[model samples]
Target chain A: MDFFSQWVAFQTIVTKEIRRFTRIWVQTLLPPAITIALYFVIFGNLIGSRIGTMNGFDYIDYIVPGLIMMSVITNSYSNVVSSFFSTKFQRSVEELMVSPVPNYVIIGGFVTGGVCRGLAVGGIVTILALGFADLKLTNIFVTLSVVLLTAAMFSLAGFINAVYAKSFDDISIVPTFVLTPLTYLGGVFYSISLLPDFWYNVSLINPIVYMVNGFRYGILGVSDVSLWVTYGMLTLFIVSLYTWAWYLLSRGIGLRQ
Target chain B: MSSALKISGLKKTYGNTFEALKGIDFGVQPGDFMALLGPNGAGKSTTIGIISSLVNKSGGKVEVFGKDMDTQPYECKLDIGIVPQEFNFNQFEKVGNILKTQAGYFGIKPGLAEERAEKYLKLLGLWEKRDEMSRMLSGGMKRRLMIARALVHEPRLLILDEPTAGVDIELRRSMWDFLREINEQGTTIILTTHYLEEAEQLCRTIAIIDQGEIIENTDMKSLLKQLDKETFVLDVQGDLEKVKSIQGYRINLVDEHCIEVEVSKGQTLNQLFSDLSELNIEIISLRNKANRLEELFVSLVENKGAA
Candidate 1:
């Protein structure tokens, strides 16, 4: 099939995946929103009252984008991992295997599903953040671009995880050991400028730093790294991951018999 | 007829030193019903897996309808449908949706998918089960559902792997009729089974695999004819022990007053009868006991490695 037709097929799989999540709104869509709200109550209200603003915004405003981005990363990653793994477990992946659909369509269909869940949770978290902080968007394009890049990156990561995973335990290991640490140190609640120089330098290594700052630059017009560098790094990360993902898919890495 | 599939030196070896397929070659022609017969772990599933693109091959090549799989898989795959031995449909989805989604994988539109799904489900006696989750279906129904899902796109080559292994005899016959109807309609079918009778009744050509090698591949009748040995059951007037001295024959005592002897073709039964008569064993009845198809199937896989 041509690119246009393949994309239409990808769209169908994506819609089915999205409907699966939306149908279970209580389990998938609602939990993260509520969790972020709880974070706002304890971390922003109770905790921020003692320490004044570090980035010249209220503690609630400072943490909003980071929390939302974190939710997006986890949701997008989890959605693909769980969904793809379930297909593998149930042997339903053979449906695509037996068809003439190219490997790229399978990857595109699955990654888009992850992106939808990520964006859905991110969007819901944004609404929750709205009630807590008076946030503004100085650059709409940068804000949307950074959010989308983050989604694409994590969704691709999730796709890779699902491909290599043999069992349910294999999917959970990265989230617990790798992803949680990266998100915690990504400068979510605090600016790197407030940290010691060594720690601040180390923070630059986290890919999430560029994304959080990129979105922060879009909304608050204040950022630690130059917006270009953040945008450049995020773009590079997305391309490199996408290329690797496509290569793995084309070779039928863990999907083939 | 031109070959529908041609395989040459196909091999698959995993990273863990497990060799699943060891350079096997076979072919099937258009509208021919071919059966791959083997014991479990005889590489039947692995062979089907590689053909359907589910398994990665380590070496060699496969061509479908004259197109090399590695060069233009889409051109080859467009006409092929694989009904895997295992149930591979989504248990969470309704049967109708499962079949429709499979059609969509081939870029077929929803309307076309629906029409095709209805046609297959109804034909398979599963139209009412359309709304039920696939996991809820019985084992036989689920197997039929796999066939329906495979043919939703009207593929020209249908590969059925053990389609009716565990089903009842009646259902097995019904499935054979159904498959034969499709085959008559110009769908070349490649079936793999441990059930030799299924092959005897359905396939025109048969290949027997044992210990990762194609031991035999020929017309079904030819393979059966190779066993030109005849076996007969004799109902003797006297005790069975009296017939033990038949010259140039192996005697098997079925029960008292009856003895079964195996003789090479054209080696006269009259010779054995007279030899027994010299031993004072008079027979009341004589019956042929050789099932040639079974004999061929057994002798091929009888721990003798390759034929």
Candidate 2:
């Protein structure tokens, strides 16, 4: 295929992926909105008032970046995992497998769809956060870069999960056990500075903490970790995960008979 | 003319054991309609899967329109299309969307994709259900939908794995007509079907695979000619009492009005009709006791098993 043809194939897959989630917006989009809204009401407005300020900002304000990042992480990961796995289960991925579309085009298209949904939900949750606290972006470039890179990273991770998943249960296992725990301990609700030194060091080992703190740095210019290190870690994860997913796809792992 | 598809020394083994295909070799000339026949557990599906790149081959060389599939898979894939035995489309998608999405996979522009989708849908009698979700369509419609999807790209070679399985006879005949028309228009087709009559009616070349090997690969006429005798059931207009061993024909009286005749090669049916006429018996109708191809297929497989 020529460059134009490859581009068209990529666009087709992305459009189909977007249409699939948007068509079932009640199931895919609405729940995240409601969940984020509830978090704002209960965690931000209700309990944040009692907690007062942390890290030189109001409790609600400090957690806004973390919550928004969390939404992006979870939605982006789930979107690709569920969509790709469903195709595998239905055997409809054969449509793409037998076509002239390259594996990279397929992978790029799904990741693009995941990023779109992630950014969308993150935007919605940001709007919801506005209802609880006045939030401002300290650095627009850094904020956009962190969210985009994080979404891409998790989207690639989801693709890998889908590739290895033998059943639907396998897809959720990572999210339920590894992802949820990592997100909570990543300092979504509190600064790691409040933790004992030993726990703070351990929290630093969790990848999500750097993402949350990097995004926090982007939004408020305050981070528990160095901004340079956070950016480096995000880039490293994205590159490695993308390379691994591509390898798996080219090998036809968990797909071909 | 160049061959439409060529396979040389193709082989596949599942895991560490279970050899599915063992060094099978064949080729289909451009514009030829060929049948890849086999019983369950035969390597027909495996060969088709390897050609379509759905299943990786353990060893072999496959060329589509002279392009090596291993090296130029994208180009080879673009030149061919496949309708698998099972329904593989998204059931939740609209019929039109399914075809359009398939066209898109081939990098077809939206306008052209729409036009081609409309053409195939209408040809396959699916235009009316274009707006309906695919799952809502009946079984036959779903099968037709798969055909339309496969044809959306207008591939030069089309591979159908049991395209008419479970379809009613009427629909099956119509599908045969459609397939014949396409083949006449210069599209090479490779079909795998359990119905031997379907192969006899549509394909000119036949390849029978069994026990991971191609046991028979020849022209249809030549394969049928391998049968030494054919059984025919005749309905007589007058009462027939007893079986008679006529010269060069073995006859059995099935009932008062029916008789079975086994005609060997080099025997003329005209002589039997003459004898029946002399007996004051009129022939109402006559038909083959079994599909000629079915008999040939069974004998070939049996011979291979015995060997």
Candidate 3:
């Protein structure tokens, strides 16, 4: 199949993917929204009432961007990792591999699903954030663009993780070791400006910091770094990760016997 | 000019030195059921994998219905469907949905896909399990479901790898009946199975591959004739064969009740029985020694002493 037919297959894959997660909506889509709500209540309203603002914005508002972005990051990563690994575990991947579908189509199909799930959970959490505070979208285009780019980037990351994964343990290792650290140091709860000079310079190299702040700049109209630079970094990461995923798939990575 | 599958000089050497298929070549005639029979390491699955474009070939050319697989894969692969040895359908999906989704994979539209899905599912006895999760289906049902999914496209050439493995005898027999009907209606089939009896019963032509090479490829009757050149078992009442005289047969006194002899296919057991009668020995019974092909297969792959 060429690009158009593959695009159709991609649509089927995304719909199936959305259905897979949504079929057990209480476990998949609801958890992130509820978790984001809890974050707002405990960290935004209860705790922010004492900590005050670090980025010249109200504490509740500052944390809202991070909480929403966190939803995007975790949901996107988990969605692809779990779905791809389950397909492999069930040995159903051979069904797709033998078909006329190209490797890129398979990659596009799964990654797009992850991005949709990520952005979807992010969108739901964003709506839930409205109940806590007046959420801002200073630039609707930027917010939507950055949210999509971040979702794509993390979804690609999750796909690569799935390719290298052998078991359920392999899926969780990256999230626990890499993703958790990245999200925590991602300038989600606090600004990089609050870090000491050396620590601030160290945090500059962290990719998630740019993603969170790019989203921050999108939502609240404030950022610690250049918005263009954040967009540039996100664009680069998206290409690099997607390219790596396609390469792994073409190589059959861990899939072929 | 009329081959359903054409493979030429295919090789697959993985991870440097392990060459699974070392330059193999064959073709399946259209509307024929060709059985690929081989020992464990004879590279049947690798060949199937390459033809289906799942495993990348190290070297060679393949064409389906005369279309080059490399240059125009989609057109070549569109007419072929593969049913692997293992269960590969989506277990979480229903039997109906799995077939429908598989049809959609081939760009078959939804309405037509559903119609085809229902037809194959009903034919495979899976219409009853249409709404049930595939993981909940029995193993035999899953096997049938795989066949349904493969046939949803109404493929012209079907490749089944061990389609009857691990299946119960009743299901296996019925499945063979179903496949025979399909092949009679002109769907070419290439099946690889460890069930020699299945191959013997279904395939008109058989190819015996050993160590990545085709050792013998001939009509199934001719292959069976290799074993008909056979063994003779003598059932005598008492100790008799202390003295044995037979030119074309190797005779042995196994015990008081029996003697074993290997003879050429054209040699008659009655001739030996009459010869024993001339010696005043009463014959009790006579039977062929080895199974039709088991002895020949053993002698071919093992028992090199005969060669």
Instruction: Report, for every candidate in turn, its global Cα lDDT versus the true structure.
Output: 0.85, 0.92, 0.84
> Pick by TM-score: which candidate is best?
2
Give lDDT tens digits, candidate 3, residues B164-201: 98999999999999999999999999899987778878
Q: What docking grade applies to model 1? A: medium
Model 2 share of native interface contacts: 0.77
Q: Is candidate 1 or candidate 2 better by TM-score?
A: 2
Q: What is the lDDT of residue A79 in candidate 1?
A: 90
- Candidate 3: share of reference interface contacts reproduced: 0.44
Model 1 off-target regions past 4 Å? B15-20, B230-251, B257-291
In candidate 3, what are the lDDT values of residues A108-135, reduced to their tens digit? Answer: 7787888888888988988898888778
Q: Pairs clashing in candidate 3?
A: none
Off by over 4 Å in 2: B237-239
Give the docking tier of candidate 2: high
Could you arrange the candidates by lDDT from highest to lowest?
2, 1, 3
Best by DockQ: 2
- Error at B225, model 2, angstroms: 2.3
Q: In candidate 1, what are the lDDT values of residues A99-214, reduced to their tens digit?
A: 77877787778888888899999998888888878889899999898888888788888888888899999999999999989988888888988889899999988888888888
lDDT winner? 2
Worst lDDT 10-window in candidate 1 chain A: A1-10
Total clashing residue pairs per candidate?
1, 0, 0
